[model samples]
Target: MAEEWRRETGGRRTSAARERFERIYHTLRDRICLLDYPPDTRLSEEALAEEFGISRTPLRRVLGLLEAQGLLKSVQGVGTIVTDVDLDELAQVYQLRMELAELLGKLSPVMPDEETLALFRAHHKRSLGLIDKPDPRTFARLNMDFLQALLLITGNEPLRDISERLYFQTTRIWLKLTAHMDIAEEVAVFSREIGDILAAVEIGDLEAAGYIRRSHISMSFTRLKKLTI
Candidate 1:
């Protein structure tokens, strides 16, 4: 009984550690996406460990994962630096995202529960509020939330993983250029996309929903390219 108790205790500890790791990863990722840690910003491992009240070892693991995700890069002399965004270089990545967006519904798609659908409607409502008063950071957060909710409809693990990674890899691109772009127009476009997605999901047409996502991605990329040029 004591051995069993220890095993259970160890399992709980492991789960807790994993949760903390994921939380740290997401926090760092969001900061990067929001451009809080802009390009070439070197992360201080000691400072981060101190801020999180953890040692560097576990923190390194989190940073390592972010590095693997293309958000950060290790330099010879400097620490991990946030990578810069380039639309031209990432053009292929955007194309891949557009292609994969169509698969969100094609591969083992799961019908979202009512709660998930309601949450999407909530996202749609919130997005409308931003159309007139566009806050790029808030809009970005809302877009991220919408993506997470939309991913629930995909039951394929690999599809979900790759889709999410690709999403994050490119999310910072728009945020990086918001100062040069018309954010209000972008917000309006985003609101419409959310509305269209919700409508498609409401009628149990996830395939249409996927196509809508693909269309928006393609259009957004086109807009970005034009802005950059």
Candidate 2:
């Protein structure tokens, strides 16, 4: 589809390359989010292009997208480096997230469709099973999936777009702290919070659902603060 779009647009020099660039872009973005490529890590355009079997031209395009997302920066004398989170900004962003989450909860369908509920239940069971599984990455992925699925119940494009941006922007923060996070404790908290919120939604108690969601977000920030300076 990307190739077809590019071809139809008839862009010279770059039409045939959009698909490859997009794939590479998402791969690097996920690595950045998961800390597979840690902050302050230097990204060499030449090395990356070679690694991905692409050329510098398309590689720069991918890097540009990551930079625009605030995940990468080009430095003089050094190479492109992963951008570090500003502490104050992190606090403010997460604070805003609390309210945004509340609003989303209030706005989401009071009774989500059967598919949505089933997905939530699957995530719930998976989250419970991971509590003592000794794999932080797996659990974190499941938690992310659960939250994302729940957020989809809102069916608000603008809201989902903004919320998702904030989500990925801060996701690295949580992923970075997995080393210090208590897996069992984190799992238990997430399970209870998700359970309560879903229960409220099932009963059409949007107000209670919203409150529970806000409180859940607040608790996350509180825990993150404790680990931060």
Per-residue CA lDDT of candidate 2, range 1-229, in tens? 2332343335554635666666787789778877888899998888898999878987887787678668899998998999877677887888777787777755644467788777777877877777667476776677668767767657555666567666667878877778787867888888888788678767666667767877988888899899886
Off by over 4 Å in 2: 1-23, 50-54, 106-111, 203-210
| Alpha-carbon local distance difference test for all models | 0.87, 0.74
Error of 1 at 120 (Å): 0.4
In model 2, the worst 10-residue window by lDDT is 1-10
Clashing pairs in 2: none
Name every residue pair that clashes in candidate 1.
none
| Clash number by candidate, in order | 0, 0
Q: For candidate 2, what is the lDDT? A: 0.74
**Top of the candidates by lDDT:** 1
